[model samples]
Target: MKTKLLLLSAISALMFVSSCSSDDDTITPSIPELEALELSNCSSGIAEGETLILENRNNGVDYIINCTYPVNGDLIIDPGVTIQFGTDATIRVYNSGSIQALGTAQNKVVFTGEDKVPGSWKGLYIISSDVKNKIEYATIEYAGAVGDDGAILLWSDTHLKMNNTNITNSQTYGLHANTNNNELILENNTITACKAPMYLDASYVSAISNGSYTGNNTDAIIVDRGFIDEDHTWTKLNVPYHFPNGVDVVAGGNLTVMPGVIMKFGQDSRLFINEGASGPKPSIIAVGTAAEPIVFTSIDNVMSAWRGIYFDSPNALNEIGFATIENASNPDQEGAIETWYGTVLNVHDVTFKDIQNCAIHQYKFPADPDTLTRSNLTYINVANAFCQN
Candidate 1:
């Protein structure tokens, strides 16, 4: 009798295992959507200083971040949560709060508005913050503001980890990082259809290994006054947009521009180094190579002249060999007269020109003599123009 009972049990266990295997094989994964996601109580409308967890995996239901109250703490978004935009609203990471949007490469969280125009909506705004943000595998689009804002307007000191995020249709800038010491590790991102693709104005920051910039009006990469870390490098970063230049290094003091760059300016566009807010000297060491000349041209149509490179900085420039500048509106400015103080200019080898103003002119100080001494210009035009005061 015991042997018979054991045999029956063994048979029952085999049948159960077969049934489980069949169920596993038959189960299919659900498809994702792009609709408004209504979270549970634990993941619902966030109050002031509240931490709401987004726990939905359906992309069809877009998560609405209509929080009337200001966020004060960290809002941790778990992986696999697709928070689509509600109408024309955006997930504003305000105050000292943070949006730790952690997504996988296969599945990225998208935040967009109903309209796809320039002023269609607002995106993650990091205003007056002191927080560390982590946004990976996300798509942000159709966002911009009038007064010093953009799709992802970052102000104050904030550490960010932006990877594989596609930013598009932003009016001002796709990603604008503005501050003194804000560190960002941006990698494998696509920026398109924006005024300025990526605007970096900070110190000790890094953007490595990005794909391309397309359909922009102004500059692809605008590196304003600030220190970019030496270790950072860009590769395969194409600028198919109709911007002024691939990279426009505006007038800022004590900046170190490095090598391994490929630039293409648009029609009638120029790389301008305009005067800064403060009267500090600006400089750029644009060093290119013989085999691979750092190209500067227009995407629209070949023109007689475009501002290939224009330095209006009042700092001493140390131009090394291996750079090739072409198609400029004006040669290096000629020092015809003096008007402002702390204005100095210097150049070498770097060719191409049609300068409209003095290459180097000094603002004569009423009392100081050093102003007159430092205010000078020096030019070496092989095929371009140069100026010295």
Candidate 2:
């Protein structure tokens, strides 16, 4: 009887295993193996005319790269394509390369790391200046390893139009432009889950468009130490522009700050608007609407956190309206603005909030607020002190 029971138990166990195997086969279909693109460290990239199409060939992985992949020619990727990376694996788009990864809303192109965590691999690096280097409707995650500063690093003189891309899970910035010379066109993109949304030169502040720069570890754009040395308009973005260092509007600089634009300056930093003897006069036209006023304040929201704006230009185009200047003016100064001789500043409807002394500090001695504005200037928590001769 014991022998018969043991045989029955073995048969039952075998039947149960067979049922589970049939259910697994029904649930998960057989998928082809992914095409492995074994790339060594800085391998010789693709040449021209030979296109590399990264398609969704297997179960969630189309192409798996072992190391850093270089694109020295045309590299095209279609929708629903998944490109997985190994440790520190990155894709470098070089000067001779052009990548047109056009994905759709429903079927998006994916760039991810094998570990599926932040700092798992190096991110995309675009060093090409090709006009065809564009990427849209894509998702990049688990990038920004220790070797690089950002997940997507754009070198100087590079041109890229990246739209509708979702960048997340980065250990550092989602994007970083090394300098102001790159032609970066960004639109409708969402960058989140990174140290910061981006770190760019002060000259590249206008390259940003309507996108989501918030929802990160720091909801701001790290404006590097640079100057607005050309005529550019800083369009309004959702997050504040955090300036870690001082900036200037030197010769040939005409900066225009649009409505709803927020600028947060570093400690003891100041904005100098000056020009040389014979060049395009430096000017600023910061005209904000009543509904959407512009803001220039301290990054840390501390009292007298920054030095203040200094006007040294004689250009007639210097205009500021419907704005707020706050948390500014160091102990050595007496106002939020320091003006010199021949300076032309047309300021109106501006709310000077949390200022140290007067609203305008005239370098010609005895700071006068009446000399800066015509009317409609409001003050909140201002000391109303005067500068000495």
Candidate 3:
């Protein structure tokens, strides 16, 4: 520190002397500047221990990714470091590699395209399960160049933590988690101006929380076919979840949906609980509060656009309360809620609407079914309140 001060004092003295000699004699001090680093530099060890450390140069973009660059070692990005990706550029962190792009609210790391347009780059892909693979206080934009994955692709079994980030202007889905099972945490992130916000399997939809996925070109979360073979919870995200196909709660699986979750199903969609006769008796616990009821409806508002919830198991754990199930009962299928003989279920405080068939179609029933007389159930524009199949 003392040496720096002395050097500054000497420079000041020289400038003063130069001013006395000739006011126009201006000397620009020379400071060595670091060259821009490319993503290929990180493919091999740029530092000790096979780690690449990128610091903020307090200027323009510090790194350029021009190809499908592979990071073979650990990479650390400091706050306020900007990375400009060229056409078709992508960052692929291998299984042995990890990336930690830590930034602050005041100084966020930026990953953007040189062309300032969507689809200018291929985006980042994380295939590692390293604990250090985290991205926070960052802005990822102008990605989703390919028709495959989105701005960020998380492979199977990878652990990626992304929070407080902004992802915008993607050509396709903002983020894609093509994983069988991955610990991808998303919290307090905002995604907008993209074609679609996200694409992931049903099991990974619970990873999102308090995130803004609306105001995009397509304002819906596209979840893959809901074939959950394990215990999974469908969390209530701000944006509605659209299931283009059916949801099968097969054996060895239990599905639980949180309250206030708006689930939109396409045609021929059905929520089958314990459909197959193997393993344990699975259940669907879709219990919601009356104030914030869970909703299960077809994407189309017409009547009977899809098959409804079906329960084939005799599991006593099946319960559906304070929910709105509508637009169900196909031509060849049963009603909104179907239960065969000996299947145990607890259905109450629910509203059945726009059904082409009975609200609750049981295989055998003694009393005449009517939601008008029932205290716990409500019906609106329904064909039949309940009936024996």
Candidate 4:
């Protein structure tokens, strides 16, 4: 009996040891902390032959980039890096300098101001024409100081490939591309809480995919000044083009507005379609379907919020069909669709609503009324259907 009891006790102890080994195998390992790097005596700007690799800097000191001399080297920032800027501090990249801040999906680089308020620090300026500049998975906030270019300013003829970046809380424009040849490749970027999310010339935009502009104080996208020199089409996939300062179709430019596109104009803003000096006269072909019509309205949705669309000596190819012109037309001036210098406009199947003045106004009528094809014109709450001067 004693031998059998001892055998049972030995088997129980073996079972207990096996259970302990199995539990140890299933235990999760603790993750290691990120190593911090010290940036104590870093100066204002990064000069030539210097490379700045910003790691985890949780210190309270701010990095000021005065840019006394142009940058000519690489400023590489790793993932999970945070940079705080001093008052009116700006990092200007010039002389073919480049910045490669490639962050991962889980880790992101950040740039903010000392006060953590909008307009506290000057933003990043890329004045170099180098195409090697890139920023991905980063958060740039609380920028737009006085005399500074927007949060991310591109003054040179460079191409910036930005992906999964967030630019917010800017006192002025979120991303301002001033140069004509500055191309932007934007994808999955969220720009919000700024005066203007994007202040760019529409012609300079290379490509945009999954870009979000929301909660901006003023216009979402302000087209600063450039003629669309190519055959461009604004589709429904990119709707609600908020133009605070208005856009002009200069000579040799052609703009086609697709169906179901919403164009919001700011106060006193107008879409000026100017005549070409030599080449094919600039024209606007805004044709929409019955089910999906193009809408041109004021941003505030108030009466006479904008100056309306002005066709300054447009060509015969210009046409406005299946469109809705609303909240346009000053009570003291011309109407929503104005033709200047006897410019014959083709209007068909178009609706004019909430117009303060006439639905269509012309400086002078065509010799024959039929010269301006006005068919299926639906007018509602308009002071006058047609006004001729």
How well does candidate 3 match the true structure in TM-score terms?
A: 0.85
Better of 1 and 3 by TM-score: 3
Q: Which wins on TM-score, candidate 2 or candidate 3?
A: 2
Cα lDDT of model 4 by residue, 1-389, tens digit: 99999999999999998877854476579755544433334453466777766655443332333322245677887786776776676677775578877878887888887788998887888876667788999999998875665998888577688899999988888888857677678788889888877877777543556678878886456666566766777766342777776778767778888888788888888888877566667888999999999999988988889888888754787899999999888854487988777465799999999988888887764463434568999988888899877
Best by TM-score: 2
lDDT of 1 by residue, 1-389 (tens): 99999999999999998877854476568666545554433333355566767665554544654332244567777666655444345555565577787777876666665565665666677653444578888877777745546788776666677888888888788888757656677888888888878776634224545556777786457655444322233333565223433344443434343454655555445544445565444555555555643444444434333444444455555343444443344333233222245545333344332234433334445565542232122333323232333
Clash pairs of candidate 4? Answer: 44-65
Structural similarity to truth (TM-score) of each candidate: 0.61, 0.86, 0.85, 0.76
Q: How accurate is candidate 2 locally (lDDT)?
A: 0.84
Instruction: Report lDDT per candidate.
Output: 0.55, 0.84, 0.84, 0.76
lDDT of 1 at 338: 24
- Per-residue CA lDDT of candidate 3, range 187-208, in tens? 8899999988998888777778
Q: Candidate 4, after superposition: displacement of residue 134 in Å? A: 1.8
Colliding pairs, model 3:
none
State in Å the error of residue 343, model 4. Answer: 4.4
Model 2: lowest-lDDT 10 consecutive positions: 365-374
Error of 2 at 175 (Å): 0.3
Ranking by TM-score: 2, 3, 4, 1
lDDT of 4 at 32: 56
> How big is the positional error of residue 307 in model 3, measured in Å on the Cα after superposition?
0.9
